[model samples]
Target: MSRHSQVRESSQLQRRLESLNTARELAEGVLPEQELQSVYDVLERAASRRSLSAEHTVVGFFGATGSGKSSLFNAVSGSELATAAARRPTTSAPLAGIWGEDGSGPLLDWLDVKERHTLPPVPGLADEHTGLVLLDLPDFDSTRVENREIVQRMVGMVDVLVWVLDPQKYADAAVHNDFLRPMASHGAVTLVVLNQVDKLSSADASAVMQSLEGILARDGLGQVRVLSASALTGDGVQTLRGAIRNVVVQREATTQRLAADVTRAATELARASGEGEARGIKGNAKARLASELSTAANVPVVVDAVQRSFKRESAKRTGWPVTRWLLRFRPDPLRRLNLGRDDTRPELSRTSLPPAGAPERARTDAAVRDFADDASTGAPGPWRAAIRGVARDGREQLPDALDQAIAGTDLKATKRPLWWVLFNTLQWLALLLAVGGLGWLGVLAVLGYFQMPVPEVPRTEGWPWPTLMVVGGVVLGIVLAISGRMLGGWAARVRASGAAKRLKAAVAAVAEQRIVEPVEVEITRLKAFNAALKAARSG
Candidate 1:
């Protein structure tokens, strides 16, 4: 590869790593940790391996028991570095055969390979095999728990995997199902060799290879390279060496392996998160939730108080002066509930409104559940659960928040209307005129009683002025009081409607802050997480 190509490839790898990190961060609370543990381990292993060496490619030979991996290891390295023992689990620990001396030591140490062999450089093959560090790993199917553990750790840490299979156990389900199927996304850095092919004839060997390839294709590893080799007769050993050499010379195995790891991890996350994007809260759902919350907060009760209070105060201001005092004995509805306009710190003082009953609470909960369901429709199960969880948690704080919202709202019930002032002034003037007329009549009667010459009372249009004042003022004030009562009813309805709107709006705000917003936040997080997984999976 050219220098520019190398730089671009490195940049792509870095971007993939960054995208994976983004997905991991977003998936923390949304996904179960047990489902994401493998991805976490892959990321940690990638970081540790990348920090060590970029030039060396670590390829491990993994297989079941009696797979002749050690024999193949020795044949490829041209030295008896690994013992081809007849025991069940010959390679208890990992053995590293380093073809290059420059940067293999630290990489080997990172791999925790204590038994390392430095191979002598061959004249024509030195350039082809340089920087190759091959590991002979323990059998994955070993009876010893520690041996299986080592294999598992080394499988994730290696840059390339070469599965060696004997003709006898080449079709084993344990290896194919547990190992090969899971590593399907790592086809670029994977190779499967049917080792010990010397035991079969030429035609049988071809048949075995074909059968193994068929099994691999079914395991989602159709693109992986398959080879047949024999360590005993040295058949196809050079071909195997050439394949490993090509990977080393290109120096892209480490990048390819890490990229494959990221792809696999992203695929797992996508599966858990499910498909599709979050459609935000529906308009009808929000409306319904607000309505339900208003009911639960007793907004209607407050609105009724406002209407009755307005009428009572109107009667005090506009009633006939003779009977207006009677209305004062009746208590103001809103004042009785401690929700009157006189309250300056309503939020600090609880209103006398009744607590929400069971039916109100159930309706509120059902409304919240419906809202969350609508917002999370078509989302994955886990994402849906997460959104509902947020909504449920916020529901616990709703009652207090709704009360505070109701108390804080400016209902405008206590404000005096301009018409009331005009009517009040007119009533006082009528009362004074009637009182003056009565006093004049009393003076005339007293003069008649003293047997003096009574003065002729002033008259206008054939009627005494005092008589007209007395009867006309009383009749006009009574008419005005009756008109005021009718108008106050209309104004009371208008004020009640306005107060209902304001109170409902306050309740809606409480619902939004306590429930809707939290659910939306979870939905947004799930969408971002899914997007990040898509980017991580992309080339």
Candidate 2:
């Protein structure tokens, strides 16, 4: 690969790695635990492997028993590194072969390949295969569990995988279904080889290769390169070396392998994350919930108390002063409910409202659930469940908080109307008139008893001045008192209606702060998470 190509590949790989990390973060609570752990494991292994040697290409040879994998490894490196004995599972542990000197110590250590050998640079192939690190991993189908585990670990760490198979076992289900089919995305860094092809005729060899190609194509590996080679006779050894040399020259197998891993992880995450962005709670849904919560909080009861309280206060302020005192004998409705402002009252005073009965409480609970369900409509199962939890949280605080809210509200009950003053003044003037007339009458009676001289008594159309003053004062006072009563009733109703409006508004505010906002917060978080996950998958 050219210098420019290397730079572009590096930049692309960096972007992919970043996306993988973002996907992992977004999928933390959403995806299955093990699936994300697998992604993290890949990233950690890739980082460690790259830190050791970006120049070297680690190619692993994986096959079942009797697949001639060790023979192929020896032929490629031109060294007898792994034991190619005719046994069930000859290779117990992985063997490493390095070309062009400085050993990939850290890389091999990370791969846990203890058997290491340094190969002399191939005569004509020295420059092309300079940084090759060939690994002959243990048989994946080995009877020993430990051997199979070693193969599995090495397979993930290697930059490229060369799956070697004999003519008989090339179509084996274990090799195809277990490994090759699943790793189809790594086609860029994968190669398949049919070993010991020298034993068959040209026609038979062609037929077997064609069959293998068909099987690989069905396994979602249609683009993967398959080659015929005989490790024993060195028939196609040069051709296999040429293929590996091309990969070694590029120095991009590590990044390609890691990129493929990231793609695989992101795909699984996308499946679990579901589709589309989160739609937050709707406005009408919130209003409906608030209405239900108002009912649950006994807002109606408080509003009714406000109206009655307003009426009681209005009567005291606007009625006839003499009899207005009688209105105070009946307890103010709001004061009895332990609501409204009292300067002498303690700050922590709770409203004396009754607890919600079963029917009302059930309606409130159902409304909260229904709101959550509606808000989370079409959301994934996990988000819906989360929304429901958000709605139910802090429910125990509702009753107490509501009572406090009602108590804290200003009912405007202390204000007296100006009309009361005018009526009281009129009554006072009438009383004074009656008192003067009575005193005048007493004076006349006294003068008559002693036979003293008296001034002529004033009269209006034959009615005595004292009698008219006394009777007129009493009759006018009575009419004014009746008018005050009628006016007070009308004013009380108006004030009560206004108070009810204010009280209902206060209740709506409480519902928003306590219930609606929390659910919306979850919706916002879900939206952010979905956006991040989308970028991760696309990148």
Candidate 3:
């Protein structure tokens, strides 16, 4: 390849590698572990192979059991590098044939090839194929399981694949379905050689080549070159040599192979992540969730307590001084609920409110599920499941969080109303007047009984001053007490309504922290994954 082309390839590879890393992180808890690990393995293998030498082009000769790949390996190298036979599974392990001065030791070592051979320079082909490293891999259809495994492992590491097929098995289902079809996108680094074409007449050879080409095209490998050659007769070997030499000279086989692998991986990951974009949760859905959580947290109960507490305090302020102290005998409603007090960390404090019953718990669970479902609408199945999982991740912590929110809320209940203070002062004055009038009457009665001289009492508007003071003070106090009770009821309602609003807001915050936040995080992850995949696939 030209220098500019090589640089472009390197840049694309870097971008693909970065994309793979991002996909790995995003798929951690969402996708199946095995699926993600497979992609990770692909990336690691590609990175390790590239870390070796970039000069040598490692091409493997792969075929089914009687395809004569070992013969073709020898023909390509122009030397007897591997034993060739018509029998099945002749090659057990991979045999490498190097054709350059540079020792591909590290590359072969990474490829795990133990048997090696060096080919002498061909008359006119030595310089062109200098950096080529050819391998005769074991039969992919080997009866021995280990031999088949060796082929499978080497398939991913090789820079290029050259499939050698005999006329009889060129169209074999296993070869086409298992290998050719899957590696379709790797056409730039793939070739197919029809070995043993010498066994057929010229017309038959052409017909067989034509039929194989059709099959390969259906396998999505239409761009892959199909050549007819014979290792035994050395016929058409020159053409195959030219193909391998061009690949070696260009030095793009490795790049194309890695790029194809990345494309396949990215495609698979995108499928697992879903195709649609995340629109996020709807506003009404969040409000409904908050309302449901409030019910479950007993916010209404706390609000009721606040109202009752206000009324009790109001009664103390406006009642007759003689009986105002009686209001204190009863406990404040909000205090009993462990609310209406200042607390630095309400999350740590347990509310005295009643434990949620079965109905409340069920409602909360259903609402959470509904919220996840609504948020995940139009998402893929796996992402929807992940969204639901996120919502429930901190479910056990929710009850405590909600209770803390209620307890930590400032209900404004502690501040007494100014009107209450004014009414209270009047009540105290009235009580004092009644007591003074009684004292005066008692003194006058005692003097009269003792036959001592008694002073005449003052009168106001033709009424005895002491008698008027006693009757008026008593009547005024009774009337004031009755009026205070009516006003206290109205004031209690206003305070309760305000408290309900504040408490609901606190409950909404709790819902956000415990449920909505987690769901949003998953949605964000999905968006990131989608963008990464897009970058990976971008032209």
Candidate 4:
């Protein structure tokens, strides 16, 4: 083939493999673990197959429990290598008989065999066979469950399988439905050996082979070679041996089969667009999800919450005197009002941004987490969490999607500003200076009242100097107090604004880190897979 044609063929094959993989994934969802493994194992082997320089063949001795595989094994090797018995499961484990001078290391590894047997080449039985491994595995149609599993697992490892069957059970449902039909894809490497055909008349033997051929054809293993062989009469064992050598030993059938499987598997890989979702969130749904998320904790929502909080604080800070508040707006006995901010904010940082609240930010965060957990009902994990809205409603809990939104984020806060400590210090100093001025003014007034020229008896009280001292102190106190209050208020405003800015930033960051980017990633993956699936389907 030309380079271009080969590339195209390779591409086509890759597509098919991916579709097969997807189908397998679907099948695995419903099938039992063992059965799924059997199907998937073929696909996996198909992937590992590569064109090899020299050929090696594996002829497997596969049959029902009482089909005399051990007898055939001994006959083919021209010696007693396998134990033929009357047990329900004749072969308890796989015993490989390699006819190769080249080490059977890799082949055995592929088959995952722990037990091995070496048989020297006999004149007719193993002639011209440099790389043939005769594998006798446990029976598929056996009462022992492990026997069946062993056979099923080893099937894909062998190149060409020589199925041994007795005349009585050749047409059994267990033989056909359990083994043949499902493996119809491997027709090119399948053969049937009617063991103990000498038990039947020549005509009956021919008739059975004919019928079996027809069944094999229906299963797509048409052209399946059939031979009448018997270990008892030694009738067709030589012919069967020659045939095995022709396919597995001389002709390098195993190598060819492996190449084809490799090509097929490569084709599947080429077709795939790679991992991720099949179909991504799209159209109205994406827009809807995003919109809903924004409504929950969007910029506007958070800003609104902060503003409301500000108004309440303002009313207290600049409103009626503290004494009047104590008498009029005392704490409500019925309501469980929080006096301090809750610790829920730090906890919520585990999965989401801090939640909104009137009093305790921590409590707000907890409520938001609870709400978000409630939102992603059918979705799996933090992957599809609800967008936790800002605390809009006056309720204790945040909207349902906050944790999902938060958990998705990396939760890395930006580095604290370098001047943050300096700024904090300046604010504290300004407040203290104003408070100190208020104390000084109070002391000056008290001293002035006492020293008002009441020293008729002694010089204990002074008039002018004391008045002057009080005047200067009062004037200095007024200026300092006024300036101090202004500076202190300014500092408070700056602090609150900075905090609000950080919060807004944190909220936006949570959206970006958690929900937005992840959704985009999932979308990209799904698109790639979908593209691959489409290409495969096209091919």
Candidate 5:
């Protein structure tokens, strides 16, 4: 593919992966803690540097019980470095064949092994191949399950795999399913050798090679090179040596494997970020959830408890136009700061979003915990903290969302802003001042026209129109300012409240799906992988 095509394919894959990851995260947040934690644990390890050799690659020998893996290792290194026998299950422990007399410094460091059963360098191997560090791993389907794990780990880390299958186990199910077939992605790194092919007649050996080639093709390893070799007779051993030299020495395989691994890790990290940016809800999803929950709780009609309280407090704040200005001064549910201060309290005099019963409240609390887990459980970064951020402004937001939705749906409201109060006050002051000024102007004109001394009008006792006028005019001017300020704050407050609700609702909905679905998906994937492995083993 062209570079552009490759980039586009990558981007497309990234999007699909992100959606899957998002579902997973949301699942964690809404699912039971133990299940969610399991997801987190896997994710954390998946992108991490589990194997020491980020650069050094694994080379493994995998076959049935009697495969001469250890003898081959000894033959390759010119030393009795590994134990090979019919009853022993060949090379119980992984053995390394370092290329240089200089020792496998970076190679071992990359593998992260503190020590190895060391082998002397093959004479021309080190000087010929710079980075080659070959290995003989335990059989993949050995009686020892730990050996299987060892080989499995090696497959993830290793650059090249040299399959050493004897004629009897060459078509073995254990070797195919447990060792070979599942590694479809690593076909380019695989080499198939029929060990002990010399035991058969020449025609039979050719037939076996052809049969193995067909099997490889069927296993999605169409391009894998099939070589016939007899460790007993030294047949085609030099060809195998040349192939290993091409990779282990030149260090070509590690880069390709690393590139693939790194790309997968990057993809997972991007998934942790989710698809593009989350423009949370234009309104709160949680409010939908909360409203649903409140209905479930029988909060509105069943008990008439919270809804009544909400109505009473709402009425009080909205009652008399004269005293309503005091409502402006009381507090904004969405505003953390007062008119000039930042004092915040979540306790509702009327409507509160706190979880109520042990069951319903449990669900609410569970939702918060679940959303938190969801936000966080993705790989390679501070996910829990991100989840926590989602919950930070949650309480204040849900109630506001409920309020706004209730307003838009059930009631019509030109809800006043603080600026509206100021504007009205200013306009009232302007009118009062205009009245007082007019009265004074009347007194001035009367004195000037009659040529008589104007009597000094005493200040009014009860209703101070002059003071009222000044106050009213100022209040009116403040009201005028309200228009300018309303657009942004209204938009912000409405969104903030709406988002709080939407987050609660969407998280709840998304979490609802996560309860058993994630486990189901993983189980299915694992089963498919195992089935392929078993078929390979039977080969």
Candidate 6:
């Protein structure tokens, strides 16, 4: 491959790694730790592998015991660097064979391989295997626990995997189920060799190869190349070498390996997090939540107080002058509750309204739960639980927040109407007229008692003016008082309606801040996580 193509491939791999990291961060508390651990391990391994040699391609030979993987390793290396013995598990530790002297000591050390052999350059072959580092790994199905552990660790770290299987064990359940099946997504960098094929006739060998191909297809690795090779007669070993040379020349095995790892990890995460799109909190759900919160905050009680207080103040202003002062002894309903304040610092004071009872609290809780359920309708269990947990945590602050919202609201109940002032002036004028007429009548009575001539009172409407003035004034003042009372009652209702709206609006604000927003935030997070996972999985 050209330098430009290599750069592009490297950039793509970097983007994939970033996307995987983003997914891991988003899934931190939202997904189960066990489910997310695989992603974490993939990222760690990718980072470590990238930090090592990018110039060299590390090919590992893995197989069960008696698979002759060590013999094949030696056959490919063109030297007996690996001990091919009759022992069931000959390769205890990994053996490294360097082709072109690229200073692979650091890379080998990272792989924990103590045994290393350097192959001398052989004219045309040297160019073919320039930057190849072959590893002879321990048997995956070994009896010893440490040997199995080494194979498992090396499986993830190697750039290319070559599973060497003898015909006898090629279809072994332990090799196919435990190893090959799990690596289904890594077909790009994987190769399977049916080693020791020279032990059978050519027709039998072809039959066994066909059967192995069928099994591999079922394992989701149908695209992986399967080669027939033998260490005894060197049959097909040259083809295997040519395949390795092609991979080394392209210099894309490392990137392909890491990309496959990321893809597999992202697939697992996507499965754990359900594929459903999050439908956010519904409109009716929000409305119901606000309504329940308003009830819990005693908003109706505050609205009623506003109505009664408006009427009380109205009576003091528009009542008959003689009896209006009597209304002052009655307490203002809103004042009694320490509400309807005109000051800017109302929030500093608490209202005397009663605390929410058990039923109100229960309704509020149910509303919050229902909202969470609606928001996380199709989400996975862990994601749904996370949303509910967020809602529950935010509810702890609802009581105080609602109280402050209520106290801070401008109820507009303390404002007096213009009609009250007009009514007050008319009542005062009528009272004065009645008093003046009474005084005039009294003077006439005194004059009669003293035997003096009394002045004739003016008459209108077939009645004396003073008598008419006293009767009409008193009657007009009483009529005005009754009319004002009726008007005030209607105005009180209007004021109460306005106050109810304001109080409910305040409660809605509290509900949104304390409950709805937090739950929606969790939903939005799930959306972002899913998007990142999609990007991680994309080519």
Give the TM-scores of the predictions, in the order they appear: 0.96, 0.85, 0.93, 0.49, 0.47, 0.93
The candidate 5 region of ten consecutive residues with least summed lDDT is 335-344
Q: What residue pairs clash in candidate 6, if any at all?
A: none
**What TM-score does prediction 6 earn?**
0.93
Give per-residue lDDT, candidate 6, residue 335: 81
Better of 2 and 4 by TM-score: 2
Ranked by lDDT, the better of candidates 4 and 5 is 4
Q: Which candidate tops lDDT? A: 6
The models' CA-based lDDT, in order, is 0.86, 0.77, 0.84, 0.55, 0.51, 0.87
Give per-residue lDDT, candidate 3, residue 525: 86
User: In angstroms, how far off is 27's CA in candidate 1?
Assistant: 1.7
| Per-residue C-alpha lDDT of model 4 across residues 180-288, encoded as one tens digit per residue | 7766656667778999987899899899989888887887678678788999888888898888766653453544454445434334433332332323333444344
- TM-score for candidate 4: 0.49
State in Å the error of residue 370, model 6: 2.2
> What's the C-alpha lDDT at position 90 in model 1?
86
Candidate 3 residues 1-539, lDDT tens each? 79899989889888987887797788788888877987898899888977878888898999887788888878788887687444533888888888774758888999999888777786434543477788989999998999989998988889999998899999899989888898887899899999999999999999999999999999999988999999889898999988888888888888888888888778778776769866688899999999989888888888789889888888888888788888888999888887777644565677799888889888888988889888988777788888989888756677778887887888897788888888888887787788888889989999999999999999988887778778888888888888888898998999889988888899888888889999999898888888887877663
Summarize candidate 1's per-residue lDDT along 238-266 as a digit string, tens digits.
88888888887788889899999999988
Tell me how far the alpha carbon of residue 122 in candidate 1 is from the true structure, in angstroms, after superposition.
4.8
Query: Residue 261 of model 1: what lDDT?
Result: 90
Candidate 5 clash total? 63
